[model samples]
Target: MAAKRILLLAGDFVEDYEIMVPFQMLTMVGHTVHAVSPGKAAGDQIATAIHDFEGHQTYTEKRGHNFTLNAAYADVKEADYDALLIPGGRAPEQLGTDASVLDLVRAFAAAGKPIAAVCHGPQLLAAAGVIAGRKISAYPACRAEVILAGADYATLPMDGAVTDGPFVTGPAWPAHPAWIAQFLTLLGTRIEP
Candidate 1:
């Protein structure tokens, strides 16, 4: 099968495991992973550690995954990627509000490509006007937002992911693997490792 390019939108205070799990899982399955920040440089952003709540983990240091800013908020276009993966935490709150980011998101979903959002990541979908009438599951705090965006919100086992057409969402970090699994499956790729 052809390789798939997954775009990861990250920022300071992103959930550590939420981003890394999907990145590692997809890459191990032979997909190309590109991590980019709201800024226009290939650098590290601080992420909250799953095991160490007292410390912040740098993306490059923690995962050995150096980021390449292939497209910034001002430069991103949906036509450039095969799929989109948005991780949770405070990152999405900030990233979702950017006009350019929202435009890119709308383009991706409007074009019918796979789009996955975990935890607070769904907030971006709501903000981008892409979650209306779709079924999704995000962090508990996002229930109102998702519903207000016209999505059907449900509380699942919190360990599995849910896919709605080109849109996929999960509850939280524990569901990271499930989220990536659904995404890879939709992309016609196997989910191993």
Candidate 2:
């Protein structure tokens, strides 16, 4: 299959595994993944956060590796990429409210591009008003938003991922294998070992 050019939305405090793993794994398989964030240019670095479940009501967050941006957010156009990836973390809480971010997401949705979002990443899709009638899984905390947006909140295991049409979603980083694999399917990426 031909390689897909994916635009990944990232920012300060994004989930460490959500961003890093997909970028690395997708690239390893010959996909072109562009990591970008608003107000940041190529070569700039954004701090990451590691969220772990240590038997708590919610996950605990700790400082994580600094991820360098390989593309400038200002230069991205939905027409240039075959798919969109949004990683969850504290970053989505803020990024979800950004007008430009929502617009870009809407564009991708309007064009029926494949979108893979994890955890709170669905927050962006909800805010963009594009998830209506879709079944999407996100961190449990985002259930209300998903439902309120006229979409079904997919209830799944921590390592589970769900694909509905061109959208693929999962609860957290643990769902990487399932989530990414499903996304690859949507991108028509075939990995033959």
Candidate 3:
């Protein structure tokens, strides 16, 4: 398959694994993944957060590596990319409120391009008003928001993923293998084992 240009939406406090794994995996498979964050420019970095389950009521958060942005959000042209990826973390909560981020997501949805959102990532999709009537999987706590956005939500195992048309979603980073594989299929990418 020809190399595909993929757009990755991220911000400060984005999930460490969610953002890094896919970015690295896609690049390894010959895809050009551009990581961008609103109000940030190329070479700028966003602090990442590591979320782990430790028998707590909710996941615990720890400081993670500072992820560098490869592109400037203000310069992104959604039409130039073949797919969109949104990683879950505290970033989406604020990114979802940004008009630019929402517009970027809407453009991808409008073009029928593949979109992958994991964990809290769907919050941005809901904010963009693109998940209505679609089926998706997200962090369990995001269930209400997903339903409120008119999407049918499913709770999947941590390592599971679901694909509905151009949308691929998963519960968390643990679902990376499945989530990313499904997305690559949608983007017409093939990787040999």
Model 2 ranges off by over 4 Å:
none
Candidate 3 Cα errors over 4 Å, as ranges = none
Comparing candidate 1 with candidate 2, which one achieves the higher lDDT?
A: 2
- Candidate 1 TM-score versus the reference: 0.84
Question: lDDT order of candidates, best first?
Answer: 2, 3, 1
* Model 3, C-alpha of 94: deviation from truth (Å): 0.3
Worst window of 10 by summed lDDT in candidate 1: 58-67
TM-score of each: 0.84, 0.99, 0.98
Stronger candidate by TM-score (1 vs 2): 2
Pairs of residues at least 3 apart in sequence or in different chains that clash in candidate 2: none
Candidate 1 lDDT over 1-193, as tens digits, reads: 6789888777766677777788778888788877777665544444553422335442122333323344454455667789999988777888877887888888888889999888889998999989888899998778999999999996876687899899889988778767877887889885346
Residues 19-124 of candidate 2: C-alpha lDDT, one tens digit per residue = 9999999999999999999999999999999999999999999999999999999999999999999999988888987899999999999999999999999999
Model 1: colliding residue pairs: 133-150
RMSD (Cα, Å) for all candidates, in order, is 4.9, 0.6, 0.7
Question: On lDDT, who's better, 2 or 3?
Answer: 2
